[model samples]
Target: MTRRPRNSAPEPPAHFAAADLPVRDCVELAAGLASYARRYGLAHVEVSGPPELGELIEEFGLDEVHFVDSHRRPAVDIEATPRTWRCGQRGLRCLSDQLIDAAHAPPGRVATASTLAEGTVLRFTRHNRLGDALGIVTGLEHYCRDNAVASVAVTGSPALAEVVEVFACERVRYAPLSDRAVSGDAIFARSSWSLPWLDRFHHSVSDTYGGRVRHCVTPLLLRQEPERPEREDVVYCQFDARSGTALPLRSARRLLSQVAAHGDVHVLGGPDTQYYLGHDVTYVRAELPEMVARLLSCRLFIGCDSGLGHLAGCLAVPGLIVSTDDFETTWSFFRNYASLSVIPLAAAELLLS
Candidate 1:
């Protein structure tokens, strides 16, 4: 959804910026631009940069951005373009006098430790694994909005973009996740050491809400579509996660058996369909929006430590988020207050009880 301009008056021509920075800097540059645009409600802001930057941000320009190329205005003198700006990341300073003179430089300036009102911007990029980025965005969306904390996500996939647009959540092509971490406020996955983005993000920012994002309830600023009837009475479940994070087949089957007692069960059709083969469960899957809608409409959600579960958290869908035996290390990164290292039925019984 597009934000209306700050005022009805005809807006001034967008301030143009020029940059030939490396891919990482360029992506940060775009995050800065999108962050600024979204914050100020510059409905008509225009942005143009290297071909990579253009391709990276153009689609976002339409919905989740303040930067647009519709003007095709001639480039501003290199000196006049907005410069030294930033949004989500930390410690990478740039000049922003031209970007906004009175407003603090490098937009989204961090608040001193003196107060929690850190008008920080939490950035998410599709490039980051869903487990790494989603909770930070949604958590900030939940706890920090009153402080003007904003979430900005940059993604090429319209589907993923749709997800973050709700939280207001990046990347320039070619930047190592390490470099990208500098632009956002929080990264929860402590294992970012190998991921590098997580390491930089966790180490750089101090406020991560004690790292229990899925535990904090969240709602998209935008209202969900009108509730429609779609098995609003069923118990929804998904025994899936990124590759190895999923539960074992026998455990999954046993879990489904227990869930069957709760009413009709819904599972997204996939390789795991085999888990429900002998059980009486309903297959439920669709486009991202439809999928979310279905989950929202469901009576309850129960799933593994996966994106869908986090998404269910955002929608305030009551559910169980079960983890595998590796819950201490590998699965812990995707955890919340309710996540558990029990068998499917055990996790459900414990949390639901």
Candidate 2:
């Protein structure tokens, strides 16, 4: 993605002053909306995850909040029954509820492509890549014009922001992080599709932290672990990249072996290691709280600069993020609560120290 020239003297709006909070999964987006709403005195806010809203409520002291389950409507009828609940299906429902709420809830000035109204809608981008960035901007333009959004705040890549301005919106604001401070105790690392780079980065971090680091992933892996014989010293978790095509499975296997050789290795998402030397690793699938507890208990967090890294940051855990240099310049891990060290692909091995 080409970098757009920074607009040094973009005209500031005179009378623009309403807050539209659209909830998404990204912590930065959530924090941005919360800040916007509090600053502007918004009466109603809509978001995807209820848990995220809980965080907002705690921060902002929400007095008039409504819970809209955009994902799953708890089946009261099935609550008493002993049937297994499909978590992924439930997650889908939560996403659906959020989308529906945004679509039907009063058509506020804030808008997404699917939900827009006349006024200024803050459209947030979902991914870090270029194509998705363009799509988000294009979608926001359509959504703003249809919903009467006078302007749009294009939040995401700098490249996408440039494309959004061409559509003649009222204004665009950038919320880039200027300074970040990572905790010395926490060292974060992860496996990217770039295998050689990930291996080198993993080693660097292990060396730096004296081979003491906690790997964090989603709670899905722990959910599958056996309940009996509860292990406390080293929590087992799995890293599931099954749904996505970009995950470096081969690199992950190699990194896993390196982790095991140095210290106790806990898998947080998946159990497959056939791609790299067929090494067997211990794993446990548990609830999100369990995963969170495990993460908070650790001093240093090492993972790919993905959602797990964000989660650790959200919990105020110090982290060392291993990512592409370009990736750090565009998308950062630190928001309001946590900070990280952005190590480029070339310097990943430095993280092991």
Candidate 3:
């Protein structure tokens, strides 16, 4: 992709007013989006994901949905571990031609070529991890000069979003995927044919956000510390969900049990945490900001290779992230280590001194 050099800040909107936007109930998905765009006076919408998304957006009667392909092409030149997930798909194979074909159809704005100005704010909609989001944004800052950036994420992402602002983002729009008029199709559904989990993430980011640019990995650029309450003797533990890097429940339980024997324990995860961990431990489940606040309130954090561990890292909260062999799969692990302390699952200890 080619971009013009942006040396200075772009001109601001002529009219600006802040208004209270309410979510109104609509019979259909299109009606709700139409109401939202009209109420907000939106000129254009940049959607993150495969191009087929514009077809879904056209149902809303809006013609200005520009698609930013989220599918990523793998780097075949760089040798990687022969993992089950790295299929090494590249080029046109990684793209969604269905969306490319749709772009040429009527309603020119839908799938039309979109342009970005110097101060244009690009908001990323694919936010699932505090560490990944932050790392990719750091790469994005390299390409974006004088441009404002923001992340459109869920309530469970506020803590990381705050850190994103510190890393040069201007705003963090909190609208959970459940609330949006989005089709909720897997962003990787198109690329699943070729790339696996690790490659999909690595290359997609390099393609979409990184733009194949090389930049230095610097210490996290947190400008100011978010005010947190006094720390408590409580230990915060979050080990939920099954993923390529998540620790097994049996191992997580053994570790948390050891930690609980020394002090009061508060678990942070989905409903499953309460069921598996038993009632003896208090489950501290809340939205993102509150979740991070709770993590900050604790003296320590312990979890599997999940986003909460990444959030704990951003707060500089001492903790151990236990992961499987996926830790050695990419160079990103070392890059993230600057902000987070991660240990292999085999070597993680129940007690930290």
Question: Which candidate should be chosen as best, given TM-score against the real structure?
Answer: 3
Q: Candidate 2: minimum summed lDDT over ten consecutive residues — where?
A: 76-85
Q: Can you write out model 1's per-residue Cα lDDT over 171-280, one digit (the tens) per residue?
A: 11222234333334222321122111212233323332332222323334433464667656788878763435576677767667777766787786564564535445
Q: Rate the local accuracy (lDDT) of all candidates.
A: 0.47, 0.37, 0.45
lDDT by residue for model 2 (184-214), tens = 1111111121122212223223222232222
Off by over 4 Å in 2: 1-247, 271-279, 329-331, 335-339
> Which candidate number would show the highest lDDT if scored against the true structure?
1
Off by over 4 Å in 1: 1-133, 139-153, 156-159, 167-222, 241-243, 269-282, 326-353
Prediction 1 global C-alpha lDDT: 0.47
> In terms of TM-score, how similar is model 1 to the real structure?
0.45
The per-residue C-alpha lDDT of model 3 at residue 85 equals 30
Structural similarity to truth (TM-score) of each candidate: 0.45, 0.32, 0.50
